[model samples]
Target: MTDTATTSSSGRRILFRVGWIVLLLLSALFAVNHIAGIWFIAASTDEQQLFEAFGVVNLLAIVLLVIPYRRREWWAWLTVWLTILPIALVVVFVPDAIGITYVVTAGVMSLGQLATLPSFRPTRTAN
Candidate 1:
């Protein structure tokens, strides 16, 4: 590749990396918030457990995104869509602050995935 082409490719990769980092940070923030919510917001044992579980899921998302997803592994992408996306979508209909936040985060995450679609595509080699 020409110098210009190389520079552009690297720049694009950096952009994608930054996007993922932002998503991971957001997920971590939400996770911590949810876990702490048990102390301040949960009024019952079940609700406390529910909040903790959400925190766990958010942590899992951070792990997946940082490791496998960053490497463009197909399974990680599928896992996020299959697990996280559905949960966020369901929470979106709750008509509450947390619900709205969850949906917005999910939407941003989805857009990130779509924006990095080319990075995940299989490359072709010359014969």
Candidate 2:
């Protein structure tokens, strides 16, 4: 096995590790949303329907993202595209409800992308 080095430093490796951690954490939050949906559906609280529906959608996203998703998987990218499009719409139309959920989800996506960056780092040809 070879130790891959990019950008002439070890910081990229460290960041990559941190990025995975963040992705796992985000996955957990989506799991929570799934559970919360169960609770909301069982209760009679205000906006219970909305809570349940949102939970189901989030659970679908969690399931989609949880599977072994390589860059080669078209469905994986489709899942990501489905997730982001709604967030973008919400941010553009419902600006006031930019909640912690948005922050956490976006942060997770950002870190996950960053983690994969080093693996695809462009190679330079020596003259």
Candidate 3:
């Protein structure tokens, strides 16, 4: 409705919205993919454990990213940083996990969102 949310093709607002949507979708896909490894007793214990482990961490990262917190805070910063380790694990160990790429892409989006921090300037100057 306002200039910041305008949807014109050339508008920064539109581009930002598109970027966010892409990131959210990627995160969702990653969460669901990891959840796919269901553990029924006596049925592929190793695979199930692996999936649960990956899924829990991926889900936690996605959840943290969605919280309404400023990027500069410790928890918000931690969310971005903490996401890197498991992603690296997946990339190195499980090449078949298509969702790792998606999670990584979403992590990029989180970084981009954090980049917006500089735009929030206070009207008063500091001493």
Q: After superposition, how far is residue 101 of candidate 3 from its true place, in Å?
A: 4.3
Candidate 2 overall lDDT versus native = 0.54
Off by over 4 Å in 2: 1-20, 34-46, 70-74, 97-104, 117-127
lDDT of 3: 0.56
Clashes of 1: 0
Please tell me which predicted candidate would have the highest lDDT against the true structure.
1
Q: How close is candidate 3 to the true structure, as a TM-score?
A: 0.54
**TM-score, cand. 1 vs. native:** 0.80
Residues 1-127 of candidate 3: C-alpha lDDT, one tens digit per residue: 4453343323444444554455455557766877865644326878788778767876776766566323324555445556545664555565665557745664675665554333323223335
Clashes counted in candidate 3 amount to 0
Q: TM-score ranking from best to worst?
A: 1, 3, 2
CA RMSD, predictions in order: 2.4, 4.9, 6.0
CA lDDT, candidate 2, residue 96: 62
Q: Ten-residue segment with the worst summed lDDT in candidate 1?
A: 83-92
Q: Cα miss at 15, model 2 (Å)?
A: 6.0
lDDT comparing candidate 1 with the true structure: 0.75
lDDT of each: 0.75, 0.54, 0.56
Candidate 1 local Cα displacement, residue 48, angstroms: 0.8
